[model samples]
Target: MDRHNVELNRERPLATPTDLASDAVRDIGAGLNGLLADVFALYLKTKNFHWHMSGPHFRDYHLLLDEHGSQIFEMTDEIAERGRKLGATSLRSIGHISRLQRILDNDSDFVSPEDMLSELRDDNKQLVAILRQLHEMTSSYNDHATTSVIENWIDEAERRSWFLFEMTRRSL
Candidate 1:
């Protein structure tokens, strides 16, 4: 049978168990959606920087951006999976991402190493802020799994942002 045509012969609707567990799941889903949006935006910006970055620190900055991009990409997948675990569909497309994300796009053609580092630092900081908010929401809902994931991601992002800032400062 076609997947779309295959239907379960059940008498009742499949209610989401998370609804009974608590409103925390719903709240966590919402926060995770927001966090996913931010992560996607940051991922794009990091890749852009990786491609366009130039200076005495070209090689180093490029490598750093690539690593950061990979981390953000992994976080995006984790957040999306969390959304699914909470009984909702994950928003994984560019349109969904653009609609939900709050981060502004950097459309400039060529970006200096300093500018790239600054942008990444700002993006990471913003991500950390969003993660912190999500952490509070998850904690309120008593969602330990989601809270722990958010905490780890927040710490990593913050550390990366601080390192980027320090590098920029030393370059000055």
Candidate 2:
């Protein structure tokens, strides 16, 4: 056999053991996985509110929810890519998200705007907390890039949650 062929045969698969190494990379990968789940949950919740929102503020709330959903969905893809870059598997499917997500599904049949806002606020707060925790872990592992990403995400989630809370409070 040609030497090149032999070398190719000896190469490890992208998903194999050789692709995995570095404690900092592993920490970033795990954090990215968890962050992906949270982003997916946030996307779904925003879409739910966008689809079902009613009352006097329906137009504004619908638009806001849709925007929020899009933002979260974009973040989901970014985090998944970050995971792959970290030499880890990215959670790309709904099944993977469900398995990894800490946030509970919102399955209410008839949801009030207030209820939706409250749920979103709670979920965002939870996401922010998780991201901050993950940031700490990643920082300990010297994964500065991943830590920075999570920190930005946490800030965005917290701001969105506060906005939603304020809107709901004004309505009350």
Which number leads on lDDT?
Answer: 2
Candidate 1 Cα lDDT to native: 0.80
Once all C-alphas are superposed, what RMSD does model 2 give against the true structure?
Answer: 3.5
User: RMSD per prediction, one decimal?
Assistant: 4.6, 3.5
Question: What TM-score does candidate 2 reach?
Answer: 0.86
Residue 127 in candidate 2 has what lDDT? 88
lDDT of each residue in 1-172, candidate 2, tens digit only = 7987567557724432333346666677777887788788878878988999999999999998988888788797788877776767777688988988898888889999888988898898898889889888877876677778888888889888988889878665
The worst-scoring run of ten residues by lDDT in candidate 1 lies at 8-17
lDDT of 1 by residue, 1-100 (tens): 5543344213213323454264665666777887888888989988988998887788888898899899888887788888777765578588988998
* Candidate 2 lDDT trough over 10 residues, lowest sum: 12-21
CA lDDT scores, all candidates in order = 0.80, 0.81
> Can you give the TM-score per candidate against the true fold?
0.86, 0.86
